[model samples]
Target: MATVIFTKNLERHLSCPSQQVSGTTVREALDNAFSDNDQLKSYVLDDQGRLRKHMLIAVDGSTISDRIHLSDSVNEQSEIYILQALSGG
Candidate 1:
């Protein structure tokens, strides 16, 4: 199982705890994490099922390249981090 972690900044808005989920891709792992929490899923994804512009997901230590599809691969021991992207100058 891969570990999915949400930043503390996002925790302020909802109940998001680090959870271990099963998946080979970022989308699968995220879907697993959000399976029980539709609200969290909405916060992270838009109506088109694409990653929201303000959100970012990183596999291991490198940021993912496919935000729309979240096709980044993950291993059993991979660390997946989901966080709100900072903005402004």
Candidate 2:
């Protein structure tokens, strides 16, 4: 079971109260999170189910490079965080 922490922006759309989740891989964890909050799915991913350009995923504080194939192995103690990247000056 991996623990996933979402930013305040994401929490507002999620049905679950806690930010933690349990899954074997990144995709599974994200899927579970989205299941509880389908509204957020489109915001973080595109129509093709690929990570949007403005979204970023970090595992244990490290950014992931494989956005399309977000199948990283997760552990019971792993921490996953999804954030919407800010842009424009």
Candidate 3:
């Protein structure tokens, strides 16, 4: 099972915790992580289900390749990290 961890900043705003879940794709892995927190889903994904612009996902130290569908593969030992993207003017 892959492990999903929300960054400290995100975890402070939301209550999502690090979890080990089963999935083959990034979407599936995230789905398992969000299964208990629907509110977190809205923060991470938009109405169309694409990753929100303010957020980013990294799998095994690399940013996900498919933001539109989260089709990036996640193996059993993968470590997935969810983080809030910072913006500056």
Best by TM-score: 1
**lDDT of candidate 1 over 1-89, digit per residue (tens):** 99999999999999999999999999999999999999999999998889999999989999999999888899999999999999998
lDDT of 2 by residue, 1-89 (tens): 77777677866765434456778878888888787566788888788878899988888888877789787777788888888788998
> What are the lDDT scores of the predictions, listed in order?
0.95, 0.78, 0.93
Candidate 3 C-alpha error for residue 75, in Å = 0.4
Q: Put down candidate 3 lDDT per residue, 23-74, tens digits, no spaces.
A: 9999999888888888999999998889999999999999998999999999
Q: Candidate 3 — which residues are off by over 4 angstroms?
A: none
When sorted by TM-score, best at the front, the candidate numbers are 1, 3, 2
User: Judged by lDDT relative to the true structure, which candidate is superior, 2 or 3?
Assistant: 3
Worst 10 residues of 2 by lDDT: 10-19
Full candidate order by lDDT, most accurate first: 1, 3, 2
TM-score of 2: 0.80
- Clashes per model (N, Cα, C within 3 A): 0, 0, 0
Residue 42 Cα positional deviation in candidate 3, in Å, after optimal superposition: 0.6
Could you tell me every candidate's TM-score relative to the true structure?
0.97, 0.80, 0.96
